[model samples]
Structure formats: structure tokens, C-alpha cells
Target: MAQRLLLRRFVSVTLRGSSGPVGSRSSARLPRLSSLSWHGTGPPSHHRAGPTAARGFCVSHASGGIFNVQDQADFTDRVINNEKPVLVDFHATWCAPCRVLGPRLEKMVAKQQGKIVMAKVDIDDHTDLALEYKVTVVPTVIAVKDGDIVDRFVGVKSEDDLEVFIKKLI
Candidate 1:
């Protein structure tokens, strides 16, 4: 099946940290964990100006204190198994709303001060995980706790509204 092949390619790209074309317009690749060089404050290396972000695809470092989930394993540990409820942000690089929501989430989560963890998943690089989560659009926000889905929404939301939603999860 086409889906099966895509899944296989996803595995190759994700686990092996290699780029593979899974029959998609964007030949998106997963940047290896050791291949990043962080600067002050901006998008990650894989997300910089290029066909990657232009195609709404990008991968970030999981070590930069941001929840850059690269695979299902990372999702299990950083989200499902987390002591605190995790907010999963399924996003794309070319998506303007996704760009806005990313920074807003960081600021708001910082205010929570450990009460909440925000996980960012680039749908392009992690299509399998995105499909598992049933994300239909960019900027899809899902709240998870105890390894279960709780609440979710799509598009950009005001920081105040977002704070209120996160507070309830706490």
C-alpha cells in the first residue's frame, strides 16, 4: 500500500536521521540530533530559509529546552509519560499561524513554570505521528495527560484563552 511505504520511509528518516522522499511534494528530512548549531533565538537549523520551511516542513532540536519531538518514542516520554499534562502543538513551518503560536506557547508555558510541557511536532518530518494524532490541519493543539488525549483545537488562540485552557489541565 502507498501508506505502508510512506510509513517505512518515515521510519528510515526518523530513526536513521536521514532524508527520504516518501512520495510527497517536499523531500523533507529529519536532521540528526548532532547536526544542529543553536544561535540566539530564532527557528532551528532545519527550519531556516530553504525548501524545507517553504514547503511547510522543518525539524528542531529536542535539546534546546523546546519540546521538539522527532518520533513516537520522544512523544511517549515527553508527553504521555510526563508528570505534567503536555500540550502537543502539531505545526508546519510555512504556516503563519503555527509560527505565531510557537512563540506564544513558549511564553505561556514558561509562566506555568513546570506545570505544563509544550511539545512541538513538525508534521512534515513526522507525518506518521501526525496521522496517529489525527491532525487534519496546521496549528492543531492537543492536550494529553496520563497517556490519553484530553482536549484539542485548531488554529491560533489568544494567550489569555490559552492560559485558561492550560490552567484547567493543571
Candidate 2:
């Protein structure tokens, strides 16, 4: 019974706690946030937060939405050697901040058009990549170019702050 109560409390706190950008947006008023569910039963759609049916890719926001990095080789091909700068989001599905920051990031990156691209590495699925980056926390964003990390940030950042960071990379 206590375990069940603890679980309930967790859910409640999670629901009320920082959903990152969403929670911040809501602070101005009673924010009507849609359900923060990570999964859906329907087929994969570009509009949903799903990597399950992407064959590999996860959620893509705006034009620069999240791109999935399957392994080291994939990372090398897509991020390190790419002609354009790449912003890698080291995240997990269970991370509430990731959920909120991701879409907002997509929107921001989209504005950049071909200037840059975004890569997503699921820490749970790609443990090696996360460990190599020394990501002890979720929602870590890294900027890479020509096989080097140019810049990075940890945890939730305001849209303006993120935009400022992205400005440095691209």
C-alpha cells in the first residue's frame, strides 16, 4: 500500500514539477499542457514523440527536429563528419525536461534551416555514446563540428538561452 502511495506521489509531483519549457510557459498562467505521454498505440507519425516506430529516428521538431543516433558509426557519419554543425541531445524518454525542451529545441533549430542539424542519443539505448560524452545527467545538449565538441549545455534552458547557445555553434 505504501509503495502504491509512493508511486502516486511521484506521478503527482512529476505532473506538477518541471516539464521544462512547458512548465516555464505555464508559470505565467494556468497552462493547459497536453498529456506528456511518451508513447502512443498508433503508427509512427512525424508529429509524435515516438522512436518506437521510426525504424530508428525519434521526434523531429520543426525542420531541425530530433534525429536518432543508433551507434558510434552512425554518430560519426551524421554528426562528426557532417558538413553542417550538429546539436546532439543526449536524452531519455523518462526525462521530463527532455520531453519539454526537445520540441522547443526543434522549433528553434528549424529556424536555422540548413545551418545546423540535431541528433538525439537515447542514453538507455545507447549507453556507450552517453558514457563517452560523460553525460551524468539527462537533457545534455552538445554541439559538434569536424569531429569535435564546440559547445554544450546541461539541464533545461529558456528559449532565449538555448537560442543564444545555438547561435555560438552555427
Candidate 3:
């Protein structure tokens, strides 16, 4: 089945770290998936000029951070379509709690490599998404099961609490 294949790919990508369409790197050295940001100067030459703020999300890899999709379409294809459950952090650039939770979530991503896919959305930049999900607070975490939000937590949660929540899901 497609789900089984996706699950296998997810496990392979996590464990072997060398099998996905995307190149692999040790989870330790890689920037947390959600830590990828683009606050730098003008757009790269490859891209046409545009409002810098409107540019898509950027994902930082070992080689360099590259532009990633900022829309829900791409996110669904890359994340929700995958077989593994996903943990999405809805955050904002200026929120203090979001900043505090960012790195912690990254650390969790590294530790739980194969088990879950961690993604982040900057609620400030993606207001529609935040509104659709009814995420009124910064640092709102939602767990997606088979592409549907099945669990959610607001505010900062300890690693133990997160772990316990995730364990219950699996």
C-alpha cells in the first residue's frame, strides 16, 4: 500500500539517513527542520526580485540554507503526505515563548529522528494558516495523524510531557 511504502521511506530516511530524495546528514549537525529561517539580504540570483518579506520559508542544510515553500500546498505534499506522523509548531518571530520553544523542539527532532517529522509555521507570516487552525497563541503545537490534527498543546511543554504525548500516539 502507499501508506506502507511511505512509512518505509520515513523509517529509512530517519534510520539510514541516506535514502530519501533529499540528501542525508547526521541529525546532530543538521539544523533543526524548523530552525530554517531567511532574514538575510536580497533574494538569491536564481529567484526574481520580490518583497523580501514575501519570500518563502528557507530550510538550512549543511551545504547552505535554501528556499522552501511557504504555502500550505507544498507543506501538505512534503509533510502530510509522508507516512509518519508530524509535529507542527505554530510560532511567530517576535513571540518570546516561541523563541524559547524553538530550540527545544529542534532537539526533540534530533532525538526522535525516525519516529516523527517536525515542522514549523511562522504564524505572523502565515496568518491564514494560523487562523484556519484557530491557533490564537504562539508556540501552539499540533500533532498530525494521517494528515489530520489529532492532538494539540498550547504554550511551553516540558520534554517529558512531549515525549509522553508522542508515546501515546505511537
In model 1, which regions exceed 4 Å deviation? 1-65
Return the candidate ranking by TM-score, descending.
Answer: 2, 1, 3
- Candidate 2 local lDDT, 29-93, one digit each (tens): 42232123222333232322212222334554455445778789988888888888889999877
List the candidates' TM-scores in order: 0.64, 0.64, 0.62
Q: Give a tens-digit lDDT track for model 3, residues 1-170.
A: 23433543454345334322222343433322212222334324332212222344467433211123377886777557857777778886657888888777767666775677677787655667778888977889888878788899999888888788777655
lDDT of 3: 0.61
Maximum-lDDT candidate: 2
Question: In model 2, which range of ten residues has the least summed lDDT?
Answer: 45-54
Ten residues in sequence with the least summed lDDT for candidate 3: 45-54
Clash pairs (backbone) in predicted model 1 = none
Candidate 3 segments exceeding 4 Å error: 1-57, 60-69
The residue pairs that clash in candidate 3, if any, are: none
Best by TM-score: 2
Cα RMSD for candidates in order: 9.5, 11.3, 16.7
lDDT of each: 0.68, 0.69, 0.61
